[model samples]
Target chain A: MNEVLLPGVGLRYEFDTAEGNRIGIVARRDGRFEVVDYDRRDPDRSRLLLRLTEEEADAVAEILGAPRIAERFADLTREVPGLSAGQVEVAADSRYVDRPLGETRARTRTGASIVAIVRGEAVIASPSPVEVLRAKDVLVVIGTPDGIAGVDRIIHAP
Target chain B: MHTSVALLLELGLILTALSALGALARRFALTPVPLYLLAGLALGEGGIAPVPAADEFVEIGAAIGVVLLLLTLGLEFSLGEFAASARRHVRSAVVDLVLNATPGAVVGWLVGLSPLGVLALAGATWVSSSGIIARLLTDLGRLGNRETPAVLSVLVLEDFAMAAYLPLLTVLAAGGSWWQAGLGVLLAVGAVAVAFVASRRWGHQIGRLLSHPEPEQLMLRVLGTTLVVAGLAELVGASAAVGAFLVGLTLTGVVADRARAVLAPLRDLFAATFFLAIGFAVDVRALLPLLPAAIALAAVTAGTKVLTGAYAASLDGVGRWGRLRAGTALIPRGEFSIVILGLAAVADPTLGALVTAYVLVLAITGPVLARLVRAPLPARSGPNVRVDRR
Candidate 1:
């Protein structure tokens, strides 16, 4: 996903779907999002505005397999090859605490993926490798049964 | 002498009843303005049972509501942005002035109102309700349209016009002499100018001063300053709401944001009361005589607004359908229209019934028309098909 500030207009978040439809979600200053679908051929077709609120946009994003919720589910299914999906809470004593996801060899060694980092009510979906994992962070991981066990052991390792 | 207990009870009853009516309005996807007006009419001076205990308090509440309404409206707009927009779209402003404001003035003349009444009526019709239009735009999903900027520019012009027009109306209603009215206008402009400069320069500082760490303190300070300024403006024979609006414009950035969060609930409460108070001021029987004229004026103004919008959008090079969308979107007049009439009605009671009738008809009609106009065009004529992925 690519986001751009439109200056006076709003924030435009543009992305291409798997089906190759170019979509843009323009979040206006007034907390409204205009979901514009760019038609490949017609300028008029691309000009339509399907407006939504933040919550509505979030729900739509989930349905579209994008944003926080859907991205996590997709990451889990993709990384695990359809085996195990579980939330492993990062205990205060865990070695992964205060470590960036890139520094953790959980993915390269264990073949497991951290789909999302849930801290309290806020969920950071599809966190980049540079994203630091904190204590008490609930990591939504995906892998085969052995890969899942490996992620737990590697994180909890003293 | 009314007992405090009786006053409290009456206030409670009125509010509860109003809440129920508000719920009913929301259920039907309509504005509560009409409902509030109807409730006011039913409980006012000539209604079935006039409210005796809390009448005075309701009146005070209504006044505060108007102040808050104008304040919040001012807060939403920045003078810098308004100046830029005004410069960019002078033609739209002129067209809007001619198409929208003229009808109310003409209607006033036809009805044999005094000069003040004509001005009052003109102000009432000149501005479409920003609150209503913003909601309609979002609901109809037209916020992303190319013509939306054009539509918004027209609205901004209307608001700026109202800031000046309100004081003129206030001076007129105060029965000032010609020279006095001239002076009033000058002072009004001066006040706005000074506020604009001050806000642009020192708005953040003022906002910081008002924006206390505690929400309670911040709310009190903001409310206190607004009331004081409003009172002073009233003392000088200008619109009090204008003063409050200036105060609002002076507080920008973080303070403005905090003010909105702190004052919105209070604004909503009093604003609702103001609408209800408008209804209460009206005599139900008088509404019957004005219904025909109100409907006629609404029909005329609706056309004029559409014309204004379409022309504005056309100037922006938007296509015919987009022009139509722009026109239809500007039809509904809500808060500001009511505020104008509310001020005028204080001097001339007859105007209340007329305005209430007019606002009600358009409030319902505007959204429906906007919705209908934006419906898909013919299959081949335009690419109106929306691609929604499941």
Candidate 2:
């Protein structure tokens, strides 16, 4: 990895993957991060991959670091009979989009508990009743298979 | 407790006008610095409207603005980065100083300015606006470019140079003799060295002393310490700005980061007021007469900045177009130039008008030129290739 100092801006770290692609990450002073790939044609210039805010960077770190989190839950579910952990994605067209998590009444209607909510790179563990559910959120539902199916039905219902 | 309604009304109106101007500048991808100066001109004597009531406040605010500016500048300093840049770009910095400062010095001599005025003008032209250029690079998505480190290193070295240069200028501006000015420079340089050593050795202890969990407490601690230090610096003729910068340099790690976050808004407000005060101090009539000279000086110095940038980029082995981009990127002269002028404005009355006009021209045109350089040459093909010039 090549670490470059940008002075008043921030530090930039660049490295080449085994695949021969050079990746650069510019960590700004204002808690913003920019990821870019070196253009093959112009080794000096880079193509911007994405810009991430501090929170988004944190969420990205979490996602990349905690890939085994769900698998751990899956292992726990294996010990019980007829119990499973399922992820229910909140589609854009879901009726409960932008509504509070309580509005889904997943626990009351389906006897399933939402263990967590994953929005983008962020995971909200043990989300409160007032936690708003946005489009494309994946709710980690823990319950029997039928109950998990029932919660999904309630979330997607018109 | 008597309050002046006129002061309140005038200040409110001025801030509103500044905000409107700032928005307009941002819309066009320009810095609001020149606009703020224009507003200051209008608000100054014999322009359009004069705010006598707010004059005292602006004056004091302007002083604080310089302190805050240097303080934050110091806060941004990292010993590691400075060492790296200095090692790589010492030649570039020397080239930058020579190529750029010469025009302003020559123009100053031609215009028959005092020896001190010549020195100040030279500095005003030499130091590119790091604030404006940094933002420009980010906005134009050139941070990831090959020549960027070269550009940034030059800026860092220039800012570090100011720590030494400012004290010398301050002593001279204060009507001190050459020996006194030389001593002041030595004193300031020694102080800077001491600051670096102290920051490295006792940084955490110093950080702990100033660090407070509450934002308000932290702000108070840092600002109070900086102001006191700045005042003492001014007393010794080292210049308050340098003192504030030293204070900034001493802080490191989390304390510096939090201090920066808390003080940013205050710095912005005061820094804008400082710019306004520079405009207010100058006579608009004087400014018009100096426009031609300012333009000519801008033209010469702008070319020099490009040459300096190209040379620096070349050191990094960047090809022709990339070098051009680097050179043009370093063109804009902003706050620091104004700060230099503000320091020496008293030496020559016309100095204010000339520097203001010069900064206004380059500050507006520099970014535009950099952007223009990018339009014709897309980064992929022509000049992005590394050329080993050994």
Candidate 3:
């Protein structure tokens, strides 16, 4: 969250959930981040555009309860793989998870995978770890809503 | 009389008036070209300022605008990608064009017009405006179906004709020898053929070159190649954009699915400018006296085009709904008609005026007619193809 590409240019970091793939990302302005990678799989497929920002990403991540899914995109590859921005729901199945709050959601959560993170009209491309899970992220988790709620408390708890 | 401020003011006034009228037409679901044309007529002869010599500028300017649109459109004509399209659509496209254009031409001749004018009209209206009809069909989630092929083929044929016939008319009117016309047509075919041959012969080398290059450099080469090829076509009397289109068509087969994305932004910018230019500095007065004729002609253009579409589509198991949709799809006319008219106008001013009047109707009423024709959409090319996937 505290990274700067250049002077006075405090760039935020993020990844989007696009076509079910994790991608690296950097944001130059508020509310729009450049997709850097989709889970370290391929870089040539760059220029993945997304509409969510770090703050909005935080809100969405918290709401979805799969903050770690943002970082651990590799887990969702088979089910809800990452992609660039613009897909709403990937239609992957998921089960609920009940877990205690711990390190980053990536370090803690198990079993539950995020199928997608649908916000307003667009999907977050390929989200990544180290990217803050926002309350706005409507994480389309594989598990039930309660499982998502438990996972939410794990990463987002102060 | 030659007040400078008055001119700018008039321009703004016309755009605003036409825009407002267009909005109203949309609200009422009436065609807007008639409204735009009416606005031109009222302001031209009936109002404070007249749109003098609209006929002259719109003639060529409209053609260029359509060229821009066609240039954008050429990307869609990629044969390879559509190879994966449904068999139903392919059959439909063939049946649709032969059925529609052939009869449509005869009927146009039956109406009061010269042979060349009738030929141009038949050619212009034969295939539905693929751009318009395809878009509406896509919106309705019917672009990939049994009838989709017929609709798309007619649309594809008409679009290609727009670029080709436009220049053909120009060559004829310019008094170029039939030899030159024959030569120009030959060159056009050759250019398109060469692109395929070259791409087949060396497409991989180009793709490899693109794989590791800076995004900027890759884009530069693409643009450079497109321009160079298109320019060559213009040098030999073929449409330059048509050449670029062929290059695109050639590359589509070689490049696979990435070609469309590569050209998306470039096409979008050029397309926007092209459409906006259609609304550019057009005079209103010259059209004043021709208003009645223009109106009548617009009706003829739309009626004939719709009938052709309906007839062509009907032969392909395109049910009543498909036929109706085809009819409405053919409603919009823009660049191709303008091209034919502009070229013909050179041989005879009367033919030119008639074509111009007709295309104007197509451009304006195209959207409205689409809106009015509310039959259930035809099926898509594949069951997996999402509605509005385009």
Worst 10 residues of 3 chain B by lDDT: B381-390
RMSD of each: 9.1, 10.2, 15.4
How do the residues A71-92 of candidate 3 rate in per-residue lDDT, one tens digit apiece? 4543544464333111112111
How does each model score on TM-score? Answer: 0.75, 0.82, 0.53
Which candidate gets the maximum lDDT versus the true structure?
Answer: 2
lDDT of 3: 0.48
- Candidate 2 vs candidate 3: the lDDT winner is 2
Best by TM-score: 2
Ranking by TM-score: 2, 1, 3
Candidate 1 per-residue lDDT over residues B331-377, each given as its tens digit? 98888988998787776765777778889899888888887774363
lDDT of 3 at B327: 66
Give a tens-digit lDDT track for model 2, residues A97-157: 6689998888988899999998855889999999999866888899999999999889887
For the second chain of model 1, what is the TM-score against the true structure's chain B?
0.94
What does the lDDT read for residue B113 in candidate 1? 78
Can you write out model 1's per-residue Cα lDDT over A32-98, one digit (the tens) per residue? 6777765454332235556577678657755654345545465657664557776677875465666
Identify the runs in model 3 with alpha carbons over 4 angstroms from their true place.
A1-158, B1-67, B81-119, B144-146, B160-167, B207-220, B253-307, B311-315, B342-352, B364-367, B370-390
Candidate 3: tens digits of C-alpha lDDT, residues B1-390: 765565466555655765687578646544454454445434432345555434343334444444444444554554442432333344544444555445436554655555666666656555444444544553453322233445555555545444455456445555676677776776766665676666667754554454322445645665666677766766767766576667565553223234444556655444433333333323344344554665665676566556666665666656665676666666776555544443454444444444445556666677667656654334323223222222
